[model samples]
Target chain A: MPMHSPTDTPLFGSWPRAYAVVLGALLLEIAFFYGLMHWFA
Target chain B: MSSLDWWILGGTIALLVLYGLYKSRGKQSFDDYTLAGQSLPWYHVGMSVMATQASAITFLSAPGQGFSDGMRFVQFYFGLPLAMVVLSITFVPIFHRLRVYTAYEFLENRFDGRVRSLTAGLFLLQRALSTGVSIYAPSIILSTILGWNIYWTNLIMGGIVLFYSVSGGTKAISYTHLTQMLIVTVAMFIAGFLTVHKLPTDMGFTDALRVAGKAGRLNLIDTTFDVKSRYNLWSGLIGGFFLQLSYFGTDQSQVGRYLTGETIKQSRIGLLMNGLLKVPMQFLILLVGVLVFVFYQFHESPVFFNKQEVERLNAGPLAGEFQVLNRQHQGLSAQRRAAVLNLQRATAQNNDAAAAAAGDQLDKADEALAKTHAAVSDLVKRNNPAADKNDVNYVFLRFILDYLPHGLIGLLIAMIFISSMGSIAAAYSSLASTTVVDIYRRVWPGSTHNEVVVSRWSTIGWGIFCVVVAQFTNRIGSSLIETVNILGSLFYGVILGIFCVAFYVRSIGGRATFWAAVVAEAVVFVCYYFDLMAFLWFNVVGCLLVVALAWLFTTLQLNLRPVRVADE
Candidate 1:
């Protein structure tokens, strides 16, 4: 599906992309925390 | 402030402003002004979301919380990950598809214009006041450390943020947040490590935890569903979930963070990252405080952690009594240290009885030390009526200043300022955006002819308003971090309720939701005023009340449906 314009009825058009984004963000956060705790401990 | 300190602060702020303005050089539409044209990558959005949440108060007061209360505060974030997941499934996709500038903008489309305005107003009031506290958190440190006028410090701190926010808007705020979060993470880690290094040669990190645990500092999980207790498993999961949901899902400051993402996927990812990391990040910060608590157990600490208060007591009529208490504290510290060492040895040998006996002795000594500290603090307060008697806010800063190496001290202090800058900048941006979009643009449609100048001036106006609010920020007690959270609870539930009704209860029209919200907010305030429940419960109560009331109103309206006039 083409990306919805700003004026579209709903904001996001794709759930797959949304899920992908959330997963990717979660991984990055986990990595950041692991490094942080290990570095300090 | 010292010449060097002033130079460091001034130079850092100047560079940020110049960089933001430099990058802001372009013809920008409303999308560019507010959402960075929705072009930022996932990393930028993630950092922005993190920075917006991790305010200066997190650094300034969290360690103090640990120093006094222990690691239990970490549980406050347990609900955050779940909140993130829920928002991903619910709020993110809808908001992303809506392409709204402010979260409340979507409410109007779903419900009515009145509901949108009410939600926006709640957000405006809460964000403005909370931003004031955020500005005040760092200003208090600069004022106390440098003995500068807090009024002027508030202006300087708030103004610096306003300058950049007004210049580059959301894009500038995001880029700076990325840098600030990086520095904050590294500096905090170093500070935590250095606290352990300051402990006696025989003690290690594990030893510190054991000592802190004995001292009642490592109380991480409290399963009891005590509404009065601020940090516990239930509050963290249930109450905190509601709070976080309202904050990230409804609050424009946070909504603006994810709104900067290039795609819905990117925005959801950034939020998910936040949800996943927030609890652990909070855990680590609180752990630093717990470790600091343990470190103090094996070493002689001050009778009162607030040095300024101690100095005043020494110069006052209570000087003699204070000295006597100080001497007594020293003796108690010596006994406590010996007792702690014995307990550690007994534990190492797996001698449970001996360990218990030694632990009891250490606890007795700790009690005596606490009495001495209380005496000193009381004396200090008696001498100076305006004194900050609660030294919990200063516990970690005291340790850092007295023990940390020179370069690290600068870095840690910088970390506090950087965190402060990140959150304050985000708040400033949010405030400006809300003012311009919700109030200004709404009131004066087709007045976009002077949008840029109006936006800049609105940023300046809100900056001044927040700084003014910061002036009355003193004497808010030790848990400044918790104080902000509690304050947020006051409005977040009502705001969240409006959104919940908007997203899920399509049958509830705007007027019903709007009036229901006003009543719900009043009820929350009444409960708070009468001390009917814990502050955390307000989030749950306010949200549930709004939804229930809105549903009732809608049901009533359905029954009273007006008959349409027949066409003759």
Candidate 2:
């Protein structure tokens, strides 16, 4: 099988963007969890 | 356990073992035995990776954590996705391209044999000891529920996994994991549903959440920047990142999972899938614990969850004192239950003032209840000083046996055992492969031994060693999950530091890197011994210290060495 280098490919048009998407999702999770804690606490 | 429950538990485990062995049939070569012939798809690799990580302790203890500490523990995994991304980018391609048997093999090529041996030795020590705890965890719970001796349970549990792992190698472990994960996911979801279903008739899931929240059980996030805190946001992201990086990147148990992938892309995607799914999965598991907490608020819970210890207290000289404590606990439990019901009703009626007042009552009741529970812990400690006073591990197990119906109880128990099997098998296989490929092979470079045979014997040997270690795990005096992580943190940082130097710092030579790792490891141990900071920071400290010290040593060695003349 051919190797797909992490830098060469893009899940969202670019590698950096793919990384950003992951980080962005993590931030969203934190925000949502914080909100849940706030709403419930 | 009833006859029907026994049938379910025994049949489920039997089916798993036969299926694993059947799927892994016709594996003769060392390559096929160790790596499943690199034929598994991304999903197999992904499931295997997840199974190897989500051990029985995770399923059993995490909900207990949620029950006691709330959702702040979820932050401990916040750095996982980031670590996954980093591993997929750097570690995946390199490992796959090299087709190495163990992660430490790559270390050898990048550095030298001693570095590989040192890192592999660290992995062997940590994984074997941690696997022992993994075996002991399910055994303890099963023993408690079934009234069996823990020693016999440990032997039986460890022996069963060892049989299959020795028979089919990594193929069996991976195939079993795929099935194991599917069943675990379903069983846990059912457990969660049943926790809610058993709540008070008028209390919906939302009401349960409100009760739990008011009791401070919904602490999902704490954005505070306290260095001494273990699971706050910043510590989780930074310290957790380093921990997970070292765990998935260097730990042969984890690396062995991804290494079974057919291609680099397969491995990368498998790791990415883990990253995407892990946090939510952990959240749901913890949420189940919170729900269980809510369930208990409307009902009665044990004053001390460890029934065995409670039984000991009942039979001992402290029986009267224990009875007094138990009566006090009963009083507090009743008050807390009443307060929670009031809070639930007020929230349902949208009476904000009433809800606030009830919340205060609930807090007071809970505080008193905690005091009674602390007294119970003290009673246990005074009765038997060698006993593990923390009952967090028993919380969920006791709930399952006490409340859940027969068939589901069996399935949940099966799930715990199967999860334990997955991780323990992976640890055995990884330890065996590392020993055979890195240490054994290098120490006797030209021995005409059958690699496959050596690998099989090594698996059996390590399995025995781990099972022996399991016997001593009862004395660790902490939650099994935390103990495992604490143990890993001690070594993972130094290992990661070695890899970081190997991959990123080109100028750092083998000797310098090696000594830097040794010095940094000592510092980590000293820091942990003196309670310098939370365990997670050890990862960050170990990695950075190694890199900095290695660079310093390398630069100093170069500068101090005399230069040779060009003419010569």
TM-score of each: 0.90, 0.96
lDDT of 2 by residue, B1-568 (tens): 6888889999888888888788767747988888988888889998999999999999888998998888789999999999998998888888888789899998778777778889999999999999999999999877897788778889988999999888877888888899888989999899999999998788788778888899999988888898789889988899999999999999999999999998776777788888888998999999999998998887888999999999999999999999998999888899998898788778878999999999999999988988888889989999998677889898999899899999988889988988888899899899999999998999999989999889889998999999999988888877888999999999999999999988887666677888888999999999999999999999999999999988888788844221221111
Error of 1 at B71 (Å): 0.9
DockQ of each: 0.10, 0.45
Report the CAPRI category for model 1.
Answer: incorrect
lDDT for each candidate structure = 0.78, 0.88
Clashing pairs in 1: A10-B97, A11-B96, A11-B97, A11-B98, A12-B96, A12-B97, A21-B269, A22-B269
Model 2 residue pairs with clashes: none
Lowest lDDT sum, 10 consecutive residues, model 1 chain B, at: B559-568
Best by lDDT: 2
Compose the digit string of candidate 1's lDDT tens values, residues B1-568.
3455556555665665676677677887777888888898878988899999998888878888878776778767766776777787788778777778888777767765666678888888888888888988887677767777768999988887777677787787788788888878988888888778878887777777667767777676666889888877788778988998999998888999998988766776677678657766887888888877777776778888877778778888889988898889889989998998898898789898987788789889878877787777778778887766778778887787777776666667766877788788788777778888878888888774667678778888988888888877666654778778878999999999988877776666667777889999999999889998888889999999999988887787744221221111
**Candidate 1, which segments miss by more than 4 Å at Cα?**
A1-41, B1-14, B558-568
What is the docking quality class of candidate 2?
Answer: acceptable
